[model samples]
Target: MDAIFIQILNGLDKGGAYALIALGLTLVFGTLGVVNFAHGALFMLGAFCAVTTQKLLTISKHVQDTSITFFDAYKDQPYLEIWWGDFGRTIIDWSVPLSILLTIPAMLLIGLSMERGLIRHFYKRSHAEQILMTFGLAIVLQEIIRSIFGANPIPTPAPDIIAGSAPIGALFGLDEALVYPWWRLIYLLFSIITVSGVFAFLQLTTFGMVVRAGMHDRETVGLLGINVERRFTVVFGLAAVVTGLAGAMYAPILSPDYHMGMDFLVLSFIVVVVGGMGSLRGAVAAGFLLGLLQSFASMNEVKTIIPGIDQIIIYLVAVVIILVRPRGLMGRKGVMED
Candidate 1:
C-alpha cells in the first residue's frame, strides 16, 4: 500500500511537468494556429535562467587555504558569503525561486521577439513549413545554449529548508513510511495553482474572452475591431512565460542540461496530441492519466510480468487512445479536420 501510494505521488509529480508544458503548447496552437517546435527551447531557456541566477549570486574570489601547507590550495569563496555573510548565503540558496523574477521578463521578450520577428511571417504557411522552421530554430537555440553552458547537466537543488521528505502518511493517517519529498509536493501544488490561474484568466477576463473568441473565429474578432492578432501575440508570450516557469521550478527535479528541452519536447507533443490539439482540459487530463500509467507500469511486479512495459506504456496508451477516439478524450469535433 505504501509503495502504491508512493507511486501515485510520483505520478502526480511527473504529471505536473507534463501538464504544464502541454498547457503552454495548447495555448500557442489554439491562439496562433501555429505548431511551434521551439516551445521546448523556451523551457530550456527558463531552466538556464535559474542556473544563471545561481552563478551570478555565487560570484566568488579564490582564497588561499593557509592550513594546507604542503600544497597551495585555493577555495572559491562566494562574494555573497563575504559581503552579507549568512543573509547572502540564504539568497544564494534561494536562487532557483529568485530566478522566477528574471524568467518572466526574459521569456516574455523572447516569445514576443519570436512571434513578431519570425512566427508572424509563417502564419499562413503550411504546417510542414512551420514545423521545419521551428525545428531549425529549436536546434539553433539548443546549440547556443550548449555553447554557453556546455554539454553537462548542472545540478540545481531545492532550498535546505524544504529539501527533505514530508510525512504525508501521518497527514493521511497511513503508515509513516509513506513519506514524499517536500519539493515534489510543492511542485504539484504549484502546477495546480498555475493551471487554475490560467483557466480563470481565460474564462473570467475580458482580454481572455476576446482571445477565446479569436480562437474560434479570428476573422469575426477582427471584424469586431479587437486586434485579435495583437492579442494572440500576447498569448504566445503568456505561453512562453508559463512554460518558462515550469522549467525554472523543475530545475531542482531534473538537472538543467542543454538537451533536456529536446528530451521533454517529444513526450510533451505526444501529450498535446493525446489530450486533443486545442483542448486545454483534455491536455491537462491526458497528462495526469499518462503520468499515472507510466508510474504504475514502472512497478517491479508489472515490469516483471511484462518486461519493459514501463518504457513503452505511454506510447502504447497514446496509440490506443488515438485509435479508439480520434478526437481524443475531451476534444471537440472538427478540431483538426481539414
Candidate 2:
C-alpha cells in the first residue's frame, strides 16, 4: 500500500510537468492555429533562466588555499556570500524560486518576438509549413543554447529548506516509508494553481471570452472589429510564459541541458494528441493519465512482467487511444477533420 501510494505521488509529480507543458502547447494551437514546435525551446530557455540566476548570484572569486602547501588549489568564494554574508547566501540558495521573475519577462519577450516576428507570417500557411519552420526555429534555438551553455547537463537544485523529502506517510497516517520530495509536492501544487489560473482567466475575463470566441470562429470575431490577431499574439506569449514556468520549476528534478527541451517536446506533442488537438481540459487530463500509467509501468513488478514497459507505456497508450478515438479523448467534432 505504501509503495502504491508513493507511486501515486510520483505519478502526480510527473503528471504536473506533462500537463503544464501540454497545456501551453494546446493553448498556442487553439489560439494561433500554428503548430509551435519551438515551444519546447522556450521551456529549455526557462530552465536556463534558473541556471543563469544561480550563476549570477554565485559569481565568485577564487581564493588560494594556503594550507595546501603540497599542491596549489583554489576555492570559489561567491560575491554574494562575500558581500551580504548570510543574506546573500540566502538569496543564492533561493535562486530557483527567484528565477521565476526573470523567467516571466524573458519568456514573455521571447514569445512575443517569435509571434510577431515569425509566427504571424505563417498564420494562414499549411500545418506542414508551420511544423517545418517552427522545427527549424527550435533547432536554431537549441544550437544557440548549446553554443552558450555547452552540451553537458547543468544541475539546478531546489532551495535548501525544501530540498529534502517530506514525511507524507506520517501526515497521512500511512506507513512511515511513504515519503516524497517536498519540491515535487510543491511542483504539483504549483501546476494545479497555474492550470486553474489559466482556465479562470480564459473563462472569466472578457479578453478570454473573446479569445475563446475567436478560437471557434476567427473570421467572425475579426469581422466584429475585435482584433483577434493581436489577442492571439498575446495568447502566444502567455503560452510561452506557462511553458517556461514548467521548465524552470522542473530544473531541480531533472538537470537542465540543451537537448532536454527536444526530449520533452515529443512526449508533450503526444500528450496533446492524446488529449485532443486543441482541447485544454483534454490536454491536462491526458497528461496526468499518461503520467500515472507511466509511473505504474515503471514498477519492478510490472517491469518484470513486461520488460521496458515504462519506457513504452506512454506511446502504447497513445496509439491505443488514437485507434479507439480518432479525434482523441476529448477532441471536438470538426478538429482536424478537414
Candidate 3:
C-alpha cells in the first residue's frame, strides 16, 4: 500500500513535467497551425537559464593561498561571498528559484526571435518542412548549448531547506515510511498553478479569447481588423515561455544537459498526440494518464508479468488510444484531421 501510494505520487510528479511541455506544444499547434519540433530546445534553454543565473551569482576571484598548498595556488572565492558574506551565500543557495525571473525574459526574447526570424517564413509550409526545419533548428540549438556549456549534465539542486524528503503518508494516518521529495511536491504544485493559470487566461481574459478565436477562425478574426498574426506571434512566444519555465523549475529534478531537449521531445510529442493534437485539456489529461501507467508499469510485480513494460508502456498506450479514437480523447473534428 505504501509503495502504491508513493508510485502514484511519483507518476503525478513525472506527469507534471510531461503536461507542462505538452501544454506548450498544444499552444503553438493550436494557435499557429505549425508543428514545432524545436519546442524541446526551448525547454533546454530554460534549464540553461537557471544554470546561467547560478554562474552569474557565483562569479569568483582567485586568491593565492600558500598555507593551503605547498606551492602557491589560488583558491576561488565567489564575488558574492566576498561582498555580502552570508547574504551572498543565501542568494547563491537560492539560485534555482531566483533564476525563474531571469528565465522569463530570456525565453520570451528567444521565442519571439525564433518566430519572427525563422518560423514566420515557414508558416504556410507543409508539416514535413516544418518538422525538418524545426528539427534541424533543435539540433543547432543543442550544438550551441553544447559548445557553451559542454555535453555533460550540470547539477542544479533544490534549496537546502526543502532538499530533504517529506513524510506525506502521515497526512493519511499511514506510517511515516512513505516519504517523498519536497522539491517534487513543490514542482507538482507549480505545475497545477501554471496549468490553471493558462486555462484561466484562455477562458476568462479578452486577450486569451482573441487568441482562441484566432485558433478557430483565424481568417474571420483577421477580417474583423484584429492583428491575428501579431497575436499568434505572442502566443508562440508564450508557448516557448511555458516550456522554458517548466525546464527551469525542473533543473533540480533532472540535471540540465545539451541532449535533455531531445530526450523529452519524443515523449512530449507522444503526449500531445495521445491528448489530441490541438486540445490543451487533452494534453494535460493524457500526460498524467500515461505518467501513471508508466509509474505502475515499473513495479517489480508488473514488470515480472510483462517484461520491460516500464520502458514501453507509454508507447503501447499511445497505439491503443490512437486505434480506438483516431481523433484522440478530445480532439476537434477538423483541427488536425486533414
- Backbone collisions counted per model: 0, 0, 0
Candidates 2 and 3 compared by lDDT, better number: 2
For model 3, the local distance difference test gives 0.92
Write down the lDDT of every candidate, Cα atoms only.
0.91, 0.92, 0.92
Lowest-sum lDDT 10-residue window in model 1 = 329-338
Q: Model 3 over residues 60-178: C-alpha lDDT tens digits?
A: 98977667766777888899989999999999999999999999999999999999999999989999999999999999999999999998999998899899999887877888787
Which run of 10 residues does model 2 get worst, by summed lDDT?
329-338
List pairs with backbone clashes in candidate 1.
Answer: none
Alpha-carbon shift of residue 253 in model 1 (angstroms): 0.9
TM-score of every model versus the real structure: 0.96, 0.96, 0.96
User: In candidate 1, which residue ranges exceed 4 Å CA deviation?
Assistant: 66-72
TM-score of 1: 0.96
Summed over model 2, clashes come to 0
For model 3, state the Cα shift of residue 170 in Å.
Answer: 2.6
Error of 1 at 12 (Å): 1.2
